[model samples]
Target: MTKPIEVRNPRTGKFDYVIIPQSPKLLSQQCHRLRRGQIQWQELGIDGRIEALQQWKQALLSERDQLTEALINDTGRLSTSLLEIDSFFSTLDRWCHLAPQLLQDTAKNTSVPFIALQQTAVPYPLVGVISPWNFPLLLSTIDAIPALLAGCAVIVKPSELTPRFVAPLMTALNTIPHLREVLSFVEGAGQTGANLIECVDLICFTGSVETGRQVAVTAANNFIPAFLELGGKDPAIVLESADIDLATSAILWGSVVNTGQSCLSIERIYVAESIFADFYHQLVAKAHKLQLAYPALENGEIGPIISEKQAAIIRDHLQDAIAKGAVIHCGGKVEELSGGWWCRPTVITEVDHSMKVMTEETFGPIMPVMPFSTVEEAVDLANDSIYGLSAAVFAESAELALEVASQLDAGAISINDAGLTAIMHEGEKNAFKFSGLGGSRMGADGIKRFLRKKAYLIKTNASKDPWWFNEGESSKDI
Candidate 1:
């Protein structure tokens, strides 16, 4: 028997829950069952799949309270948990709405008069999704729902660090027997995730760059497709003509929301030299207003650092930045309050690419701001990192913002606002550099990634043409 893994409550920093990963034999059996069920699941067709998913959504809605509570316990935050639940529901609805149209088969006449083309796609039999702990429910299903809608059976393995939500989610899943046969949630750590890659036809992973690379390699060994959304050191550039108040507010929320524990978080900030002091001052003031959600999860805006390991990274980044002569205007340290690890929204200036906080994936509510004399310099600084997941650009006019955004190396860039990708899913974008690889997990590609396309080339007439072997003439004709 596998030993159970302990889970910590982010709010308390205590290991209060345990999850036992299924045995390798059991996991393989479950994969077999899901693969067998996938035939019927795919046969149900897109419309039928949509109906089953909608029913599952209803079942999940009934278990909403329990699921919400589990998520709150898992992540040690209230409002964000609620938002995660909402986002999961929205994702389900969005995929259900988009799948039918996106999955439709098409027939077209070819340039050759006697030929016609029929295009269609078949779903990958089984898809394995390994999601992160930051937004447990949302990230876990972000790929699963679309894959399910595309007629693929899905098995999700969420982070063992936050596995509490799996029970209620499974309960909801079980209510729809048809869906249950095709969709499952497995609880385990890295080994489980690696094992899952061997059992599925495709794998979708949302996590760190280090782990993502491992998943990619394992999936390659298994000869399966791997779609990864990895780490980010997303940067936000504030132009001189930008509104300091607007830029600061948007950048603050983008950098620190979810305690900056997101792949899309704007960790590095580059501002026009003219507004450098004012920008940092406004950012610090806003950072000070946010409080830790300690004792009570509702006490404040900032939540406890969700992972203890992540908390240590946050502390190390802060220490490195301070040691490197970065000036911390507010919230410089990670504090242990009532056994929970919390850091107030920290705003630092006098920072450069040399500091870990500026270049590394801090994954904390720490923002390092630097000044650039020219727009070109700002763009260069923002593009200096190994990560190019996403970024943002702020300017007085829409045209200027778009122009600046066009020069960035990141996948998704928000103009005038920040973290729009968190809410907006209609745009199709691919991660650049070490951020990630594979197709877009947004827009039409989300569901399409689960499918393999096939084309039927038809001859409109019965007569054999010039392209044939010409049996009668053969060598003599040549």
Candidate 2:
């Protein structure tokens, strides 16, 4: 028997939960069973699959309170935990509505008069998902739901850092026998995640670039596809003509929401030189109003740094920025309050890419603002990163905002707003650069990625093709 893994509570900073990873032999057996069950799952057809999913959704709804409480304890946040649950529900409904239309087979006439073309897709039998800790429940299921809709059996292994939610989630899954046969959640650390890649037909991972690189290599060695959603140092550009109030408000939320523990959060800010002073002043004022949800979860906008390792990274970035002569407008340090790590929406200025806070993925509520003399300079500064997940642009009008947004190197730019991709799933986008890999995990492609396309060419007539050799011709004849 493998020893159980101890889990840390983000709020109280105690090792309060434990999870035992499935033994390798047991994991292999589970994979074999799930693969065998996928045959029946696919045979159920789209309508049947949708029915089974909706049933599971209802089961999940019944366990909502328990799941919510578990997530709050898992992440040390209140409001975002509730939002995560709602997002999960909406994701189920959206995929159920979209899958049938997206997965329908197509038939059409070929260029050759006597031939017809029929196109269909087959789902890979088993899909493995390795999710991160920040938004434990939401990220874990983001790819799984669509894969299930596409008729793929899915196994998800959420991060060990936040495994408390798995118990309640499993309880919900147990109530739906049909879905239970094809879908499951395992609790484990990196080794288990690595083992999962070997057991599945495809893998989807959401985490740091370092780990994502390892997942990709393992998937390649195993001869399977790996869809990776990695880290980012996402940027936001504010124009001279932009509304200082609106821009600061939008950027503040984009930068510090969930205490900035998101890949799409605005870590770097570039403002037009003409309005740089006003922009920073208003941003500092808005950022100062935020509070850490420490003593009570309802006390403020910012939550405790969910991962202890992440808190250290935030601290290092702050120290590096200060040493390099960056000015902290407010909330500069990562503080420990009753053993929980917290940062209250830090806003910094006079920053550049020379500091780690500006160039690297801090993954905290640290916003470092810089000034740009021209549009060219702002665009250049924003594009000067190895990461390009998403970004934001603020201008006087939609047209102006879009103009700047068009030049960003990232996928999914928010015009006149920020982090719209977090709430809106209808628009399809790819994670550019080190942000991610494989097909878009939004819009129609989310489900389509699980399917492999096959084409059927049909001959309408029995006659042999004109290019074929004459039936009775000699081999040497020209």
Candidate 3:
């Protein structure tokens, strides 16, 4: 199944070079000896790993503009949105700085069979993180930083769209002497990616559920573990009690950030019907204030969609929503003029659960806004999606917002803010989601995903008489 792909660059409309590497079987066999505990936990501790990633961080900072530009070329994201890469770098640094303390080896006495029982959590070896291009640098690096800090090397299959940065990233990583050989990068088209997954102990995948499910299935078939960070139909709720100005800014940041390419992008915006028309009018008028420039400089506020195919998908979703009697309040066009992947910031009205725009993950700059009468209805509407990855709610009262936040079924919830869940739970004891399975790329989620616990029971007394002497067992030994 592993085959080479014919690569092309859309910017110049030219064909690129070919790349091939070891198959999944060979990679798996080679890694067989590199399991957890193969290396001492303290040998390559968090401090050392952080020291190395700091260099990686510096390299990322030094080339931030260039790297963002590369991602822009591939994803058609605004140059300004490219600061998202900077966000990733900062988060990586924060993870490196924080995770060592979180991953400290600790033991506990087990209450179960409370007889001289102990529970210990240890670091495992390398994990395979298959990150997607939508926000590839951030997603992959977010997971990788924690894993490395937890004493595991990572094998990353970066999205093919922005794979250009792999060499630069690996080069930067090489400066951290210890990780030069341990952390590795391998690139290939579709099947070659699958090969990489077949080998690693754990797989942290951030992509479509379809692809994520396949990764989990493939990993499971081989008895390997997997972390599936699939897509989301994230929703933003603007209540009757909301601050219009705050909601306006939050929605713009949540939806248009990265041209709405992010998994947590606010694809669904629900405003209380009492203020629906007013909010819709203001949101559209405010959007005009933001603009995308031509041959755009790096870090531009808006960028193109990743590809013509992605644009077409966005178009189809728009057209389908409209056909189903939904209304397009703002963007609905696919611009061929940019000679790049571009779709305007979209806002849809009169949407319902039946429309794909409402029910499925668009993963584009499409915001489908609707109105509800009560908090009960709004909460239900937001939780209607199969994807429970993230949500945002804006309310006037802190008490009411906290009450609502407690009720919403999401991995992360934002009160009076959007994408706040992306930052919350730092140093908190609780996991972000009742369902997201915890962790916000790092912190508790990072530790839970990367650390597997082993329970060890040691007898305080130097006797095994209890089990050995059962029903005349071991009589000959006595």
Backbone clash total for model 3 is 9
- In model 1, the worst 10-residue window by lDDT is 469-478
lDDT of 3 by residue, 1-478 (tens): 5565544443433445344555766666556634533364337667877777777778667766677666655555555445567677667767766675666655555553435655656655777877887775676677777777777767777776667667657656667566654566667656756888767777777777777667767988978777677777888888897888879888988888767777778889989999998888888877766665446444346666664567777878888998999977777776754356566677778999999999877877777889999899988998887777777888888788878777766666777887764554363322232223323453466655777887766655555555455664555654
Query: How do the predictions measure up, each by TM-score?
Result: 0.98, 0.99, 0.87
In model 1, the clashing pairs are none
**Per TM-score, what order, best first?**
2, 1, 3
User: How accurate locally is residue 411 in candidate 3, as Cα lDDT from 0 to 100?
Assistant: 65
Stretches > 4 Å off in candidate 2: none
Per-residue error (Å), model 3, residue 57: 3.2
What is the TM-score (0 to 1) of candidate 3? 0.87
Residue 211, candidate 3: Cα error in Å is 1.2
Clashing residue pairs found in predicted model 3: 76-304, 77-303, 78-302, 78-303, 79-299, 79-300, 80-299, 80-300, 439-445
Which stretches of model 1 miss by more than 4 angstroms?
A: 474-478
Highest lDDT: give the candidate number: 2
User: What is the lDDT of every predicted structure here?
Assistant: 0.91, 0.93, 0.70
Local accuracy of candidate 2 as per-residue lDDT tens digits, 215-248:
9999999899999999999999999999999999
